[model samples]
Structures are given as structure tokens and as C-alpha cells.
Target: MNKNLIRRTAIVAAAGAASLVLAACGSSDDTSAGQSTPSAVSSAPAAQGQHNAADVAFAKGMIPHHRQAVEMADLAPTRAESAEAKKLADEIKKAQDPEIQTLSGWLTSWGEQVPAEGAMDHSAHGMAGMMTAEEMDKLKDSSGKAFDTAFMEMMIRHHEGAVAMAKTEKADGAFPDAQTMADAIIISQTAEITRMNSLLGKN
Candidate 1:
């Protein structure tokens, strides 16, 4: 071939190769971008999950409520005259301490502020059936059968409050774990209430 014709053919061949490479790169980039957008969107809802005001209230209110139950249970070992009461106290503390952790963890996962540990200020939490300072003081001062009676009465009321809160959560909360916990509280506390009533009968 002539030198001029050879040079023109080489230029055309190089241009065609460059165009194919550019088109292939753009196709790959477009495919990657298209794949990424749906993945990011699909993951967002799963990450958020189902959270609401009721779940927040349940966790916030119940943590302190459980703490108070633990505190009251601590008094049982020394002050309770009834063996039944002491045993029940141990049960209460065991169940509630871990529950406090579970509830706190939920609050953390939900991006809600967890209640500070050791703070039992439940006033204005819309929590029902909490004992007043005087009532707790009254229980602290009592001992023997008197202590047993007071403790049973107070705990029954306390459990009733917990049941009520759980019922509200079941009705209003959006989180599945929170609702499950709420159902559990209602069942367990109601049974405990029946047992407490029987304990009171012994006194």
C-alpha cells in the first residue's frame, strides 16, 4: 500500500478502538451506579426499622420502674419476715435487672437517649402505680408480718402499674421487640399478682 493510505487507515483503527473502550467504560459505570442506588435505598428502611413515640415512652418509663422494683426487692432479703417474700424478692431482682439492660439497649439502638443509671426520678413519666416517698419510707420502717403485708401490697400495686404500662405499649408501640416485652410483662406480672395475693393471705 501507499504510505499516505497506510497512515490514514491506522488513524481510523485507533479512533474506533478508543470509542469502544469509552462506551464500555460508560456502560460499566452506569450499571454500577444503577445497582448502587436501589441497594442504598433498600437498606435505609431496614436500618431505621419500626420505631415510634410509644416505644420510647415504654423504654424510658419502664427502666426506672424496673430499677425501683430492684431496689424494693433488695430490701426483702433483710426486712422480709416471710420466706416466700424473700424468695419472690430474689426472683424480682433477677428478672428486672436484665430487663433494665434490655430496655436500655433498645433505647440506644433507637437513637433515643437512655435514662441515666441510678436515677429513679419517674415523676411525669405518666407511669402509673408508683409509690410515693412516704410509702417507700413506710415499707422501709416496717418489719415481720407487718413488713410482709406492706411489701405484698406495695409489690402488687407496682406490678399492676407495670402491667398497665405494658398494655399501653402493646396497643401503641411500633417496635416488635418492645411489643413482645410488653406482652411478657403483662403475663408475668399478672401471674405474680395472683401469687402475691396468695402471699398476703398467709399474713
Candidate 2:
């Protein structure tokens, strides 16, 4: 064979081998890309998994309950005669407002309805420590020392009802978020109950 022809054939063979190597590498790259795409999609957080029915009920019920407590707190500054009573009311408002917002956000995120802005049926689920409509009406009418006593007593009962609801949530709720919130309510309200008892000289 001619030397030039031999050199040309060798060069063609080298080019063909290089092309095969590149094709193999391209195929490997395509498989890697395909594998990564599904992994990325699978790792995404699911909205449905984050909430359940128990969480929905807890958020819906708590929002209005918190709002009523806040209303009762707002009444304290004007109606309570004692500085201590006013301070307790302020504390209740400060603590509960954030929790209300938190629970409201949960309801919104879960696509659930917020509770109506009206009187709630405290007896609906056997919730204890709730004041009757008459008691609430009396609290609304009174002022000064009478207001202070009424506010404290009513709030103490309200907190107790909240505790009972929280216990129910802890027992039957499936969502971790609702369970965590229930735990917080139990802790905070228990502490408040102790404080209120001391203030009432019942401790």
C-alpha cells in the first residue's frame, strides 16, 4: 500500500473511534439527566400531606375563640379598676393575638373556612368552663372593680375551655402542626390559670 494512503486510513479509523466514545458519553449524560428530573420532582413538598381534617377543625374553631378572648382583653383596660387586672388582660391579648394569627394562617393555607364573627356554642362539644350568655352579658355591663372580677373570672373559665379543646386536639388530631399548637395552648393556659388563681386568692 502507498504510505500516504496508509496514513489516511489510520486517521479515519481514529476519528471513528473518537466518535463512538463521544456517543457513549452522550448516552450516559442523557440517562443522568432523566434520573435527576424525577428525583427533583419527587422531593417537592406536597400541600395535601401538610394538613388533615383534624388540623382544619382545630384552626377553624380556635380563630373565633381567640378573637373572643381578645375582645374580653380589650374590655379590661377600660373596665378593670385594678392595675393588676389590666396587666393580666394586656398579657392575655398579647399572647393570644399571635396564636390567633397563627391558627388563622393555618386555616387559610389549608383552604378551610374561618369561623363566623358571632357567639360560639360552648356546649356544642361538651366544652367546660365556658361562661353562659347571661354571664357574658353581665361582664359586658359591669365596670370598675366589678368589671375586674368579672373579667378575671370569665377569662379564667375561657382559658379552661380552651385547655379542654386543646386536649381533644392532642388526642384525636392527625397533623403534627395541630398537635404542636394544642401542646402550646395547654402549657400557656395552664400557666395563666395558676396566675389567675393566685390573683383571685384561690391558690
Candidate 3:
């Protein structure tokens, strides 16, 4: 071949190789961006459940226990004497009422039998820190400082029970959501218990 023709052929081959290299680099970048897609999904909130027996038990037990707390909180608006006492009661209700619904929703979503609608019929299984009929009656009957003291005493007991249950869920439960909720309960109720203890003049 002529010298000019040979040089032109060489130039054509070099251009093709450069095009292939550029295409390969583009493919590598696409793969790297695709790798990040999974990370984005992982950062999303976890799926709600894969609940185990311990999680169900925690939910069933805590709901009634929380309901009683709400009932007790409701009484505080009328019966509790101290502004601090009443405010605590209101805060308890605010925190627990939504938690009650969240727990019940999880149970239902898991195809578990939610506890009986009201008052947590603990007939089948007893929950910790439940108020006795007599105790609840006394709380309802008492007013002013008497009510304030009774409510705080009872609630401290209630919160202690919740913290215990939450700790168990953290240890034994399988569901991510349940365990997270349990952790939150342990943190919040522990603080509330401390506050109530101070209010009651206890160590």
C-alpha cells in the first residue's frame, strides 16, 4: 500500500480503540450509580414487621396497661390538685394514646387478635402493673392532694411495668419496629418514672 494510505488506516484503527475505551468507562460509571441504588433503598425505613411471639406478647400486654394509664390520665384533669400532677397526666395521655393505637395496628397487621376493645380484659393472661378494681375505685373516689398522690403512685408502678416489658421485647422480640418501639418506651417511661418519684417525695 502507498505510505499515505497506510497512515490513514492506522489513524482509523486508533480512533476505533478510543471509542471503545470511552464506552467502557461509561459502562463502569453506570454500574457505580446502580450500586448506590441499593443503598438508597436500605436507608428507607424498614418494613413494618416480621413479628415473633415475644413481640405479640409485648403488644397484647402493653395495650391494656397503656389504656389504664390513659384512663388514669383522664381522671387527672378533674381530680389531681397540683398543676404539675395534672400536666404530667396530660403528657402521659398524649404519649400513650397514640402508642396504644400503634400497638393495636401492628397486631392487626400481623394477623394477631387484638385485645378486647376496652379495659384490656386480662382474664386470659395477666399483665404487670395492672390497677386493681379497688385501687382504680379509690383513685376515682379521691380528689385533690389525695388523688394527686394516688395517681402518681399508681402511674409510677405502671411505668415501671412498661419499662420491664419493653426491655423484654428488646431482648426477645424479632420485629424491628417492635424492638424500636420498645427502646423508645424504655427511654421515655424511665424518665417519667424518675419525675414521678421526685413528685412523690420518694428516692
Q: Which stretches of candidate 1 lie over 4 Å from their true place?
A: 1-48, 122-126
Better of 1 and 2 by TM-score: 1
TM-score of each: 0.73, 0.70, 0.76
Candidate 1 structure, TM-score to reference: 0.73
lDDT of 2 by residue, 127-156 (tens): 456556687788889999889877888888
Candidate 1 local lDDT, 132-201, one digit each (tens): 7788899899888898889989999999999999999999988888888999899888999999998777
lDDT of 2 at 92: 87
Candidate 3 achieves a global lDDT of 0.86
Q: After aligning candidate 2 to the native by TM-score, how far in Å is the CA of 94 from where it should be?
A: 1.1
Candidate 2 — which residues are off by over 4 angstroms?
A: 1-48, 119-128
Worst 10 residues of 3 by lDDT: 119-128
Q: In candidate 3, which residue pairs get closer than 3 Å at backbone N, Cα or C atoms, i.e. clash?
A: none
Ordered by TM-score, highest first, the candidates read 3, 1, 2
